[model samples]
Target: MSDKITFTLHELVSELDAQADELLKARHGITGSQFIALATLADVEPTDITDLARCLGVTKAAVSKRVPSLVKAGWVTTTHPPGQGRRVLLELTDSARDLVERAGRDLDEQFAALVDHPDASGIDLSALNDHLNTLTAIFRQKGPRA
Candidate 1:
């Protein structure tokens, strides 16, 4: 690929991420990483550090490092799994559940607003989703080693 094309994509992604971070920070007073972790926990069953890392596309060590901050905030509770040696299962505190719900609602509204473009044309969302599914399958098979 040409350098210009690659740089354009990178710039676009960086701009998108920066905008998203600003929105979440202004609305929830939380960083995007924290929002992602809370949202993942809200949607999935209580998960261990390893599971959370996979869900967030981060490393287990990174998740482990964040656990203490969450614990201090009373937003998460940890439990040691028997026979798992040192694995800690993370669960959202009840208060965290409420926060997560509120944040999720806000994010949904924000995203809906962005996608509610009056000039949007010829955008088949279902087809886009199907294409994403194909891409995901290809990536899975390639195993990040391609």
Candidate 2:
């Protein structure tokens, strides 16, 4: 490979995301977005719909649409905060937790295989992760203009 960077950071990220999403969907029967939302909910005790939307990098409208389907599937539920008006918080149900756990195992196996590949010479994952973090911070700060 040439020393010159042929792909922009954004382009490389998009490509990786596409590949991961395709693989995850094919293997697990879950869309990338759904998996992300479910995973996020798995951590927090509960989250507001708006908060979940932000975490998922999607609009509240999109979250609204997705929540219903997740609710129908018995993977999530809405809870009202104590003494609060009917504004509801989102949370992953038991089934959602199990689903996310399975997905995590699958991702771990795939990641381990790549990291252990014999041909992965000169690959510095820690450094790459740091660089990507910087790039992501810069782009998030700049928004669409980035």
Candidate 3:
């Protein structure tokens, strides 16, 4: 393990993302990117593509590209609200809500197993989560770095 905290955080995030992708693929037939987009939409539905892209820390074009597959898979639907002047809003379908809930339960189980393991003994998960959340807030406040 590297002594650099930033490097370790990067590596940990990458590994976690890969594992999540594999798990989601096996259980739900969705990629991690797709899952994230869906989850974000669940948190903030009736949002425009630009807002979704900002939430995902990606480009509007990237979110736009993913919309077709999600629509085809019956996970999302887009609509134009009155007076929006061509602005498109996205929302999760009923099926997508069910899928997100189930997937969230599965991920919770996986996380519980990991935290309950002997190797994780003595770790204060609540504190860790709080610190991570604080860090995330700080980063988000700062926006993207050059």
Candidate 4:
């Protein structure tokens, strides 16, 4: 067997995301974007779109695209406070929390099952996960290259 690793960084990311998408497909009809938005909504306090977008490391327009679907799906609600005027805030319903919990469980199982990789043996997945999480945080802070 060759000692060199064949997978590129992009391929690794793509495969990881593909696995997540497959898990989501088996249960939820919502897309990954929607899942992310839902999680953000569940975690963050009421704030304007700009702040939410910044916290999400995305543009307001990108967040906006998901709002309608979220609202229509009954996972979120938007409202303008008395003094807040046109500044709208988002809130996640109980349904969103339930979905997040279920998805979180699936993700936990999916990650735990990584140690059983077909081509990998005697791998320290916990250590790999910590490194991956750290790298992801660093890259997420940096954002995409223009």
Candidate 5:
């Protein structure tokens, strides 16, 4: 490859995301973004749209847009707490929890296979993951460039 490290990294990220979306859609009938949202909800305590958006690094509008579809699909349910007029609490349904568990296992297996492939021999995946985590932290700290 040429010395365009950032370009290569961008391409890799895009391709990986595309592939993941495709796999998730085919296997679970959910988009990658939806799956991510569901996973986040599973991890965190019950929260409203704004807090969920913050956890997902997205806008409130983005999370709001997805909520209806998730509810309609039976993956999520929203409820307004007593006296909490406009604030809606979001939670994953039992089916969504099941889907998340299955998808997590499938993705984990796929990741293991990818890293264990012959072509990936000699790669220190743990160190690579640590470096990627560090890079992600730096990017989050710096925010996005103009």
Candidate 6:
């Protein structure tokens, strides 16, 4: 692709991410980061903040900050796992499952629509995800700047 096309791809991703953050806040009263933490917990095995950070390819501090918001939103609860030596186990609440399911459907619909639209039709969904994964890996290896 040309330089302009590649730049458009990057720009589109960033735009979509901002829009997603707004959508989450409007519909769920939570930020994209918080929703992501909850979604990870809902899908992944019961885990602590550290494991969740690793799973999301984000930092522990990032996940830690979101945990309190999720807890306040009634989407999560944290506790000490049995014999885990103070390891804090996180659980998704019943409300969280409902919220995730509802938001998941909305997000899925929004994504499908975006991908199907003429502006985004050139990119394959799987290819986009693969490229995003590569970007995530690179970021993890190098880390982000302040």
TM-score of 3: 0.93
Worst 10 residues of 5 by lDDT: 104-113
Off by over 4 Å in 2: 1-7, 115-119, 134-146
lDDT of 5 by residue, 1-146 (tens): 44798988988778777888988999989898888999999988489999999999999999999899999999998999999889999999999999999998887678777989898998887788899999989989998899
Which lDDT tens digits does candidate 2 get at residues 56-89?
7889888888888999988999888898776779
- The candidate with the higher lDDT, 2 or 4, is 2
- For candidate 1, the lDDT comes to 0.81
How accurate locally is residue 131 in candidate 4, as Cα lDDT from 0 to 100?
A: 88
| Superposition error at 59 for model 4 (Å) | 1.6
Highest-scoring model, TM-score: 3
Quote the RMSD, in angstroms, for model 6: 3.9
Better of 3 and 6 by lDDT: 3
Stretches > 4 Å off in candidate 5: 142-146
lDDT of 1 at 134: 100
Locate the minimum summed-lDDT window of 10 residues in model 3.
Answer: 104-113
Instruction: Please give each candidate's TM-score.
Output: 0.76, 0.74, 0.93, 0.76, 0.83, 0.73
Which one is best on lDDT? 3
Alpha-carbon runs more than 4 Å astray in model 6: 1-9, 119-146
At residue 96, candidate 1 shows an lDDT of: 86
Off by over 4 Å in 3: 144-146
Cα lDDT tens digits, model 3, 1-146, are 79999999999889878988999999999888888899999999989999999999899999999999999999999999999897899999999999999997897688778889898898787788899999999988998899
CA-RMSD of model 4: 3.6
Q: Kindly report which residue pairs in candidate 1 clash with one another.
A: none
Q: Candidate 1: minimum summed lDDT over ten consecutive residues — where?
A: 120-129
TM-score of 1: 0.76
